[model samples]
Target: MQPMSRKTQYFTDSVIRRMTRISLDCGAINLAQGFPDFDPPQAMLDRLAEVSHLGPHQYPITMGAPNFRQALARKCGRFMGLELDPDTNIVVTIGSTEAMVDTIFALTNPGDKIVMFSPYFENYHAQALFADCQPIYVPLVPPKFNFDANVLEEAFKQHPKAILICNPSNPSGKVFTYEELKLIADLCIKYDVYAIMDEVYEHIVYAPHKHTYMATLPGMWERTVSCSSLSKTYSITGWRLGYAIAPKPIMDKIKQYHDFNTVGAPAPLMEAAVVGLEMPDSYYEEFGAHYAHMKQLFTDGLRRIGIPFTDPQGAYFVLANIGPYMKKGQTDVEFCEEMARKVGVACVPGTSFFMEDVRDIVRVHFAKKDETLLEALNRLEDIKAKMA
Candidate 1:
């Protein structure tokens, strides 16, 4: 009989996915997880249908199939304005989840310190622990989620090995502005720290707000590891397609880690998704407009229901202030559970996304279809009556 590793003791199972299962059990409309209940581009589906019979099902090159990496490098260059050598730069992964862990493992040794923002995607916190490292948490002041540059500099002085930046961040959906990115980029360079970026929402940014690649920053390409996925962009969350783009030195190690951990992302799936990677600029433009429309529809619904929430600049989740509804002794978790079972809508308790005590908010995603949003809102309208 033996005990488990101490590293895992710092975290538990994903609260987001857990709530999703609970939502399923309660027969609630599951807005708890961020997967879209819509179809991906027809081009990808058609490609998949064709590729299925062609059969590359076994495995591809360790880092990625040649064509896939070429497509990715071309896409990255076209979008980010940087020509990347696919052979040395990209490590295709089983979703950004793997890309992140791979980067963490490849770059940091146990006991190293890594900088992370508060109210981050919950997985980052767990991954820190899993990587046997400590995170220096810098708070992104709420209501706007802006950070104090001075405060961030203090965190960097802690001599952390790297900073994990989730631009167009999750939960809060606060896209880091160019100035903020410059602040971070400056701090990283000054502190001689690496920047590990999660840019999965690169294409999901709302207009008037834009996503800037950290790797494209002056003198930062070599020090920044850009990790992202096709899940959110292409609506193929189930495909588990993700990757890390770094300079050769870093990517060499990431590739070694990824190769042993994963033979490679599913071969046939990569072949099909390359079609999405090569999509026209108009395709991405329409994508942003579609999400903008959904965001407007859902947020407008919340306002009509008289619920207070922070507006998202990018990504699809809204962090609603449900403080008024937290009855005498009920915690956000209890309120969320009751909302799912009785109110018939499911959401993740906001506490899950924070490093500090944050229990007045719950996260809901607007990546669903219009009909689904309408139904969720209609059910939410009876919140007071149902909870009372």
Candidate 2:
């Protein structure tokens, strides 16, 4: 037999998906994958059926469906304050997954260095490898998940080809504030580097904190490549609809690569997303309220069980420190597996987020029903009893 490509051997299966599978096998409440079990907006559902009859089933434009791009331009303009030329600057993608991979391949030359925060979305490392680029990891330390300014500046001084920023970040659920994003923008401007932002959780933010668009900052529009999806925003992960908002030149390069990547995102799905992109401002407000309610419900559950955790300011994930309960020399994978198999509550181990020594924290998702969260909490009450 011939050998597999080196690229194919570099990565492992997604730890998050595997955890979700284990949860299913145990019939556990899955707080592992960050997907909501709820339905998308009623209007989007209606539009999907409407588009099904409209005959876009074959193939739309190679870049994107026209109506979808126009709606996206309008929506992004309203929120990010950028006048986007849909034809020149937006390239619809299968998901932010494809967007990230495409953008990295487009912008990074072989051996180019890309700065990515540790505990980032796991695919990023593989994307760097696929792009034939080097990744310089900067750690986002826990609890608040703050980064040191000096550390960021030092990485910028290396003149990296690009930096990947995930706002309302996954795993820890830390939303980057305007000030933090400003510092990043300044560094990018000074270093003449690209800023690739993953803002898929843009509308799922909680109270007091807002989702800041990296491209909206002064001088950042030209340097920023923004990737986002309808997956998290509308709870329609299976739709595989996402897009990149960047300068014409960057989008041009990205489109050439994406044209052959998936050829085009699903045609009918893009037609249906027009309705989602045009949803009212109140939809976002109510969306935030819904996420806030879930966050409170989950946090309250953790508190009742005497588990210490970081309260999420934006996204739907919670990272709880489980270090205090390790009496029989348990590893993170062991702990999480036992938690799922024995207690019927599944979560992702923090070790999957970083390459460092700390795996004492477990990442949980709050994007579930109240009854579901309550049931998970009830299961967690037995944690102390299981401790040695």
Candidate 3:
């Protein structure tokens, strides 16, 4: 029999999705995946219904439907602080996942170095491996998830071809500040490297902590490829609508990679989501307020139950310390499974998010509805007895 591709040997299945399977098998309430339990905005749903009957169920151009690109260009321009040429600057992909995948393969060559913060989203590591790229991990130390400037600068000295970062980061929930973004931007410029940013949580930021587009920084516009999605902002994860915004030359290569891969996002979903892209600033204000309320509600519950968690400044995830729950020599995976079967809730073991040895933590999320979060919290109240 012919052996399979060697690249498959570099990684395992996603622990995030793996935990959802454990939840189903154990009859546990799932908190592993990050989608919201609530439905998308009523207006968007109504728009979707209307658009479904209209035409163009087939692929809209390979780049994107004309209307979708224009809407996205306007939205991006608001933060980029410059008018973006939709025709030349944006390429819509299946989702931010594809956006990153396309950009990585488009810009990087085999054995080129890709620098990323440790404890990153699991998919980024796999993408680098699949591209035949070598990943250089810089630790974003826990409890605060802040990186030392010297340490980061030293990493840039390795001559990496690109640096991948997620603002309002997944798993960690650390939002990079303007100062930090500037540091990264300056380093990218100094090193002549590309900055591939994940800005999917752009609209869901918490108060006093804003999301600044790295591309807006001086000297960064041409070097930054911003990959974002409507999935988080518009609550349309299943819709698979996302885009990569960059300067003309980079986007041309990205377009080729994107077209060769998935071609483009679903036309109907793209049409429906333009309504969200065109939403007023007040809608985003309310959007942040809603996520703020959910974060408070979930973390407040964890506090009352006497569990320790790193409170997030942005994004919907919380990395809670589950170290105390594990018996001697037990793995994070074992503890997560026990937590699911006994306590009736499931989470991803922290080991999956790291490049180094990691345990004593697990990722939970508050992206669900208030009632759903409350129910999960209620089950979590007996953690001591159940986990024992």
Candidate 3 or 1, higher TM-score: 1
- The residue-by-residue lDDT of candidate 1 on 14-95, one tens digit each, is 8889889889899999999999999999999999999999978886988888999999999988989998999999889999
Best by lDDT, which number? Answer: 1
Query: Which tens-of-lDDT digit does each residue in 1-388 have in candidate 2?
Result: 9987788687788888998899889898899888888899999999888888986899789899998999999998899877999999899999999999999999989999999887888888888998889889888887788999999899988879999988989877889999999998999998999999999988878767888899989999888999998898888999999999999989999999999989999999988888888889999888888988988988988998899999887778888888886656789888888888878888888888885677688899998888888898988887867654
TM-score of 2: 0.96
Worst 10 residues of 2 by lDDT: 379-388
| Tens digits of per-residue lDDT for model 3, 38-93 | 88888899999998899569968999999999999998898668889999999999
What is the full ranking by TM-score, best candidate first?
A: 1, 3, 2
lDDT of each: 0.92, 0.88, 0.91
In terms of lDDT, the poorest run of 10 residues in model 3 is 202-211
TM-score (C-alpha) between model 3 and the true structure: 0.98
TM-score of 1: 0.99
By TM-score, the best candidate is 1
Please give each candidate's TM-score.
0.99, 0.96, 0.98
Q: Stretches of candidate 3 above 4 Å error?
A: none
How many residue pairs clash (N, CA or C atoms closer than 3 angstroms) in each of the candidate models, in the order given? 0, 0, 0
